[model samples]
Target: MSTINTSKRTIGVSFDESGRAHVLLWAPDAKQVELLLSGQDKTVSLTRGESGYWSVETRALQPGDLYYFELDGKKQLPDPASLSQPDDVHGASQALDINRFRWTDENWRHFPLKNYIIYEMHIGTFTPEGTFAAAEKKLDYLVDLGITAVEIMPVAQFPGGRNWGYDGVFPFCVQHSYGGAQGLQSFVNASHAKGLAVVLDVVFNHVGPEGNHLQEFGPYFTEKYHTPWGNAINFDDAWCDGVRRFFVENALMWFRDFHIDALRMDAVHAIKDFSPTHILGEIRQEVDLLIQQTGRKHYLIVELDLNDTRFINPVNKAGYGMDAQWIDEFHHALRVTSGQEKTGYYSDFNAVESLAKSYQDAYVYDGAFSEHRKKYFGMKTENPGEQFVVFSQNHDHVGNRMLGERTSQLVSFEMLKLLAGAVLVSPYLPMLFMGEEYGEKNPFQYFVSHIDPELAEAVRKGRKKEFEAFYMDGEAPDPLAEDTFERSKLQWGLIDQEPHKTLLQFYKELIAIRKMQQPLCVLNRREVSVEHNTEARVIVLRRQHKLQDVICLMNFSKEEQSVDVPVYASHWCKLLGSSDLRWNGLQDIPALVPGELALALPPESITLYSNKHE
Candidate 1:
């Protein structure tokens, strides 16, 4: 189905009387136009019409038909087929009937990202099989821990059996090895069955080097801007309208066809778009329109390093209207709280005071000048206390390190318990890396499997060089090693191991308490206040809603420190502490006794307590 250009650069789909597909390719340059089809010699010598145009009408292609066009004499190109590319990298261009696949979640609305908890996992390591169905088995565990959504890492088809899906050339197709098309459907279906919404991480900045065939067809990218990975996508230049539609349609397709609840746009700051209405703004409008028409809740989440709140601000305010965005301040708070000072970015936060500011205000660097960036940052969120996704450990914070050690590896078992308490209780949405609950020991190294040896070597060398000073006492893990991907897999058996099992249990308990306690889930930032000892780097926060009051504390030093209720409360109950040594699973300390219960903060430990009487 195809239609003639209406106005500007717009084209619509159309069908003939017999349901045959017809398209009018606007390119008038070719001396010949051949439709590359499965069994037909579609090399129809097109009649040249007025105004430099060529038109072709073909019998309606089947759903799985791979069709392309040979324009002029030397170009084999994907259809202006008005369908989608299921196999990124232009593998076999597919002619799709949008109505072919029946989606089951008809009455399903997307889960709200606000006050939600997310678990980010990579399909390759989620299970031994590393398929969608294999990962489905773990959905119950996430639900059991009160996680609301499962954000799978990029699933666009990449090379070989495994790689972080970032370097994928195909933005539309599901990864073939990780259960491809059907696997994705099953994964989403199973997740919805368990009441967990699915959020996908999408990369729109640039396609990888291998398998990228868009350039062979048109001006899909431009050198007008640059990104660390490659040339920036041409968003506002010539043929930029086509490139924009390619990605915008891709996003709508994910929600409309696949039932994905939300999308975390990967590193939006890296995406350079200079259009009058930025790409993010257009994507938001298109997504919201689809949601209204379908009556489903769809969220656009930006994983932005820029502290600009306009990304999450409502559309009425001339902002992007994204439902939520990732907040790195919380990560920095937890990072600082544990005395883990790995500088570079850490230079912005060398003191516990910065951590407290983040917890209270939701932005530690809220317009303050920074030494590392040497610039003021983090414009205040007009509406503070919003529930944006905050994490103690994420793929970048871990994988970008010398060795991708999780927060569990960086801090003590006790500190792991403290980190969970602080995040869950804060007035922000909480996120956990796939195995952060049990503290799995695998490192997420930067790995790729491009066919070109030079590109692979460059990636490996680049990673090694970037983290030379950050590596933990040894050489950077070999990015090209078969063992690298293998080692990245989570050890499910760790759930039964000592200390690991205890921490996993601790996570479940903490989440349960958060859901059950009104004050633990406080919704407003102004309602939460922080006071900590500058000398000892000891901290305590009090959160009070209409129903109950909660206190959270952390000791960022080797020696234990004690503090009276930082608030004017005469008596404070110790609801929980990291190093009651009860994290052993054998020891269990009852909720703290009211009336100034003594606190013992261990080295790099965090603790939580409830003001017994609200």
Candidate 2:
């Protein structure tokens, strides 16, 4: 067997020991490939190497030079492994020396997965400027809010300025509108300096339709499987080794070149692979190797709709060996309990019992029948609590709606507190969408700026068709309209206002308690127990670690209900009450209580009690 080459990258443009640039392209069917340097009026022929690969080393090309690959001297296209696309996805690719930027995070260490309090933010809507530099200015605020990691939406270069980022075509290039490669590096550096880890969302399932030039190069896509976006990537068919290497190297680029702490893989279920070694497993194997070489911790968290635990299981157990995954069942159950309409996939979950099941078991539908799916779904697993990430509101949950109403607009203030409490108190890792902590009322509507008029119309029609089942009265907002994008921007000023101020304080307190309290901080599934009452619409969750114990009592009903404490402790001290006047609640709850006493819980509120004596 041939040993792997460690001197230079097998794909993309890389600089060797000398200053000369080495270029490699995988075009098996093409007879001749030429490199076109923009503004230099120079073209160099590439030598065809083994496995139909093309390679060339030249001193004429320098860092920051813009170039394109001319296939067979007939059609010109950007490099498939482009490091930067300064003029958007359709234009020329800019050569970038990622090592040129000096990093200041050498001493920074990643936080444990169990201790992660993730804050999900979209660059275009995070602030008024919507650039990486503008977002970096708010790092201190995130630190003050007790966030351990900041999860950014995809920065891959797309067609235009405004997009949700799933439409990205250049997987290796940062969005030019978001300040490009240098902007992201500065943002990550600042985040680490503030003691916050960075998690980048990446799309590997399918490339965006507009500005996609991979098929022009080689068999980069296959018709063997179909995805919601387009044809599946060529991962299992013939000539798949080069395709697999392209993506596997992309993952390594983020960790090795960009110094990213974690990658939140977007929609792994859409990725189809039938090879004996799955693509995810290959990426995991390479990431593990990188971790060993650097002595720095990194994570691969996937967004999967499937409830199968094989993705998170160890490789020895015939699994993909992913570090963690987002639990949509927990969000679905929690949403149903919060009075969301039971339509579409929401029809499968029950109110309080499903939420309880998610708390005890990581999956609510483990080996159970799903009415929405019309089949028995999920496999049971005994994975640790930290392996699952749970959230109340994310980009999909909020942006996919017809009117794009946030939880704050759809629910009451008291119920918001109750929902926030439910997520923070759970055994799994907690995630918060941007402005969710302060209950921002602005909608996170889906928007895009596709350059092609036909493609833009198609996206507008797709958005309308998607929400047809949930809404029928009004027409869905036009995704191409500029105001639609403007409407989605977060109103940072709202944090200083009435209910928003109180809600922000409430979130800070909840996060502080979660970090400081032992029972709440520990991610042990065995030490957690949940009990719910269907008639009263109440859920009582108990978490104990060693001598410390904490109980979270939630009232989902609109009317006040009396609940009996099942614990045997003699004294229980009140830690927080959402119904208290400080949080703008109507009533004042007790500060002290007996363990087995029946207590009156305010309508749509959550109260926390602990055995630790103050």
Candidate 1 versus truth, CA RMSD in Å, comes to 4.0
**Residue pairs in candidate 1 whose N, alpha carbon or C atoms collide under 3 angstroms:** 1-14, 2-14, 86-173, 88-170, 89-170, 574-592
lDDT of 2 by residue, 223-247 (tens): 9999988899999999998898888
Deviation in angstroms for 462 in model 1? 2.8
Candidate 1 regions exceeding 4 Å error are: 1-33, 38-57, 77-90, 95-99, 467-472, 566-574, 585-592, 595-604, 611-614
Lowest summed lDDT window (length 10), candidate 1? 1-10
Q: Report lDDT per candidate.
A: 0.72, 0.91
Cα RMSD of all models vs. native, in order, equals 4.0, 1.5
